[model samples]
Target: MTQFEALPYRHVLTVPTVPTAVRLARETTEDVLTELGVNPRHPTVGPALLILSELVTNAVRHAAAASPQTTVIYAAGEDCLAFGVHDRHPYQPSLYGAATVTEGGAGGLATVMELTLGLGGTAVVRGDADGKGKSIWITLPF
Candidate 1:
């Protein structure tokens, strides 16, 4: 007989605040989910990927101005998967109406919120303990 591991698998990745960091985060997330036995075609995977992209992109574009690196943490429980991005920017992301979105910029944070809600998940934004940075997290149920 084969033994199975317990729930709440966790992984943490740190990357430089560069454009390529988004792709790295996504790839690493996919690998971690696979190791956790999450199906690639599962409904949650797509939204999770998008969420990771948006958060990492935000970190690279905005938070990178404050710090040159950021960290991504992934936790998979029995019925949910949570992802968090930690950056050195204490400012919370701004939410804007759809009509105010420009062509090449804006709307990323809004999209993250919408997709998280659509997945029956919660999105949280808060400053880190030392008051020197911020962390954004989203939890989605499988």
Candidate 2:
């Protein structure tokens, strides 16, 4: 009889703030998830990669000024997978504000929020140790 393990896995990867960072993060995340027993063809992989790409792209595009690199933290629990992107940009977005989705599909955070919430998950921001940066964490329950 095959039984499922409830062990959790976590990985943190830091990459230079460049256009290629998006691809790097995605590849690493896929490998890590697979190593942790997630099927490579899992349904969550698609949305998870999209969220990671968006987060890394935002860091590469907007935070390069104060943050030369971005850190991606990937964690998976018994029933959820979580990703957090950290940068020293000092600007914490307002999660309390109305959703950012537009009629014609304005991407980025809006898309992230939609996918995250649709998965019955939660998203929150965590400040860096030095208080000069923030990490946006998206946790989706499977």
Candidate 3:
């Protein structure tokens, strides 16, 4: 089997549900991509970082009430890089319309979906079977 078809490289990190988690996630993502032979400056890397930031920030803002810990999973394969943020909030993310000027910025999930689609990737939301948490994942083709 080709290397690409073999098992993917995976890393998981548990972080406090705080704003600073976004920065930590981004830095860890860069390190993982580099270790996997994916260039840190690759086109997909920027969007991946942004997606990580948005998802982690959303978890901190929306789910910290349920639990103060969030888990980030990163997986890298020959053709794709995937990241998932698992949070204690049971509610799935709501994708609203484009952010208005008064909203102060683009909606997090909306931006994530847009970036993933633009990169010919996929975005998914999965809720835990126990209904205690949810995970948001984005997979981008490299």
User: Model 1, range 1-142, lDDT digits (tens) per residue?
Assistant: 0011233587999999999999999999999999989999999999899989998998898888897998998877878888889999888764324225468864888788778777888777768888889888778888
Best by TM-score: 2
**Per-residue error at 132 for model 3, in Å?**
1.0
Off by over 4 Å in 3: 1-7, 95-105
TM-score winner between candidates 1 and 3: 3
Report how far residue 45 has shifted in candidate 3, in Å: 0.6
Q: What is the lDDT of residue 141 in candidate 2?
A: 68
Tens-digit per-residue lDDT, 25-77, candidate 2: 99998898888788877778788888889889988888999999899987777
TM-score of each: 0.86, 0.87, 0.87
Q: List the residue pairs that clash in candidate 3.
A: none
User: How big is the RMSD of model 3?
Assistant: 3.9
What local lDDT score does residue 130 receive in model 2, on the 0 to 100 scale? 83
Please list all clashing residue pairs in model 2, or write none if there are none: none
lDDT string, candidate 3, 1-142, tens digits: 1222243788999999988888898899888888899877789988888988988988988999896999998877778888789998888865433222235666777787778778888777779999999887777888
| Worst 10 contiguous positions by lDDT, candidate 3 | 94-103
